[model samples]
Target: MEILEIENLAKHYEKFDLKDVSFKIRPGKIVGFIGRNGAGKTTTLKCMYNLVSPTGGKILYGGEEALKIEKRFKQEVGILFGESNYYPSQTVKNLTAVTKMFYDDWSEDLYRHYLQDFGIDENKQIKALSTGMRVKYGLALALSRGAKILLLDEPTSGLDPVSRDELLDIFIDLVGDKEHAIFFSTHVISDLEKCADDIVYIKNGEIIVNEDVTDFEASYLPRPPRQIRRYPSKRQAH
Candidate 1:
């Protein structure tokens, strides 16, 4: 079943537009939104997360219109953007305290575990952290919120190769339950190859391809035609 569905979604701006984009993310699957920079990937993601109002079309979460959902229901959705959104003066512990009040199911243990795993210093101010460390902290908070749907925008863009791989593995582990789904947008094709079950390719404010990666790969493989022998000739003669 689909955890999220976007149909005929359109978002317009002065310079660019996301035109008639449509796709679905199934439960337990990682759907990669792939495109080059300025290709409308972020616009689509923003529409999905309700951060930007769309000019047209419908967005459904688990069969209900997303716009009509209750705040409690919307709270189950988590978004990690390309840049850190935390306050510069606040430490990780301080931020988590504020987040816990907003997320009904926030788990401090899980947050702490992720902080340790990601090598984030909980006591350091957000401004003092490196770009990659800030990204890691943002991810740790997003995942620890007990969100069923994660909307991640260019999450691995600034990380080193090893950190990127580790983050990908963490995503894989998070989806092992089959109750969660992730809609992640990234220009990094290699990261998509590692974690994406389905791919949605966008270009010039339009969706070009929405397909299962395995199926697309299979279609690219060579196939041989079967040959007919004497039996076919005999039938023709009869």
Candidate 2:
């Protein structure tokens, strides 16, 4: 069954527009949303999470209109953006404390586990942490929520190769239960190639392709060599 469905989704701004975007993410699948900068990938993810309103189209989560769903529905959705906007004065522990009030499923043990696994200092203030550390904390919070669907936007963008690989492994572990699904957006093709089961490519606010990664690679090949004109052989010309 489809875990998330975006139908004819569109969002408009003064200078940009997300035009007629549509796609489906099935349960237990990791789907990669690939696009260059300003390709509406973030906009689409925001719409799915109800962070921004869509000008047109509908987003359904497990048969319920996502926009109309109750707060409880949101409890099952976890989102991580490229940059975190947490309060700089707060430490990771403090942030987790505050988040616990909002999410009944929040697990303190798991939160601490992730902090250690990601090599993040729980007592350090957000402002003191590096950008990659902030991203790690954001992911920790998301995973601790016990959510079934993870919506990540460029989650590993600024990290080094080791950090990126570690984050990728964390995601893999998150979905090991086979009950969760992940929809992640990124420009790093190699990262997607490593973890994605399906891929959706967006260009200029439109979906260029959506298919299984293997299928895309199989169908995607270098263009054939073109015929080249050569000077007629001297013998043939004679």
Candidate 3:
């Protein structure tokens, strides 16, 4: 069964309109949500998470309307917009202590494993950790809360190359279980090329393409110029 499906999703504003955006997120696959900045990527995500009301369309989780089961849907879905910069003064442990209270499935063991694996110090203040570590910490919280689907917006937007690569590696490992799915939105095509299985491309508030990553790349990759065979000029040919 599909974990999440967005059908004919639409959102409108005075200046920008998102129209007919549709896609599905399945288990164990990373679907790269690709679009340029201001191409409605964040707006679409906001609508899905109920941060913004969609002018049209519906979202489904496991074949049920999300609005009908909003609480359960929210619990199963983890959304991280950039990183955990919300409580810069608080220690990781303290922030997590509060975050865990919202989820019934929160697992301390899983949280500790992710903290160690990501080299995050729970005692460190949120501001003391680097940007990359902050994102990792967010992931730890989400996974420990038993999120089956993660919708991350620009998760690696401002990281250094090494940090970006490390995050991508973590994404790959997270899906290895074939039970988790990631719908990652970004303007960074190279990041998708590294870890995305499929892509849902958007432009000007509309979906442009939805296909396997390889197919998307092959369709857009620059092709070599055609060779032109030229016979000798007519006057000299004879």
Candidate 4:
């Protein structure tokens, strides 16, 4: 089933306008939103969450007009930004104390489990956490709330290769349940190439490519030289 849809969406500003953007995200799939730095990747994501009001078009979540968004919808959707949103002085334990009140389904046990699994210390202050740890903390909180849809903004940016791979593994495991959907924006194409089922390429405030990962890669991206040489010509030594 489709969990989210963006149809003819538009967001206007004096400096830039995101026009004619559209896409759908289904359960058990990971959709990668990709673009250059100035593209409307973040803006489109914000529109989905109602952080930015769209100038035109419709956003539907579970077949309901999302512009008339509801609180239940908020509970179903989890958001993670590129940077930490929590106060630097707060410990993970203390931050959980504040965040837990927002979700009726919040589970302390699961939250703590994620903390352990992600190698995050509950007692450490948010300021002391590394970029990857902070992202993990955010993700832990989101999962604790029983979110079905994850909207992540540049989630792997600024991380070392190992950390990026670790997060990608977690993302792959998340959709294993077959009821969750992940839509994340990133300039890091390699990360998407590894885990994304579909890729949405945006350029200068518009969507340029929205297609299955295998098709796009096979049709658009060329094979590396090493792989190309694997198929030897008959003239060459076997």
- lDDT, candidate 2, at 138: 86
**Deviation in Å, model 2, residue 33 alpha carbon:** 0.5
Backbone clashes counted, model 2: 0
- Candidate 2 lDDT, tens digit per residue, 60-167? 888889878858568988888975657999887787788778997888898888888889887988899888888888888888898889999999887889989988
Model 2: weakest 10-residue lDDT segment is 215-224
Error of 3 at 159 (Å): 2.8
Give each model a TM-score.
0.88, 0.89, 0.88, 0.89
Each model's C-alpha lDDT?
0.86, 0.85, 0.90, 0.86
Flag regions of model 4 displaced more than 4 Å.
Answer: 223-238
Tens-place lDDT per residue, model 1, 36-136, is: 88999888888877889999999998889998995845698888897575698998778778878988888888988998999988888899999988888
Q: Which candidate number has the best lDDT?
A: 3
Worst 10 residues of 1 by lDDT: 216-225
Candidate 3 TM-score over all chains jointly: 0.88
| Count of clashing pairs, candidate 1 | 0
Off by over 4 Å in 3: 222-238
Better of 1 and 2 by lDDT: 1
Q: Could you give candidate 3's per-residue lDDT for residues 88-165 as a string of tens digits?
A: 999998999998999998999999988887889889999999887887788788778888899999888767788788
Q: Provide the clash count, candidate 4.
A: 0
Off by over 4 Å in 2: 221-238
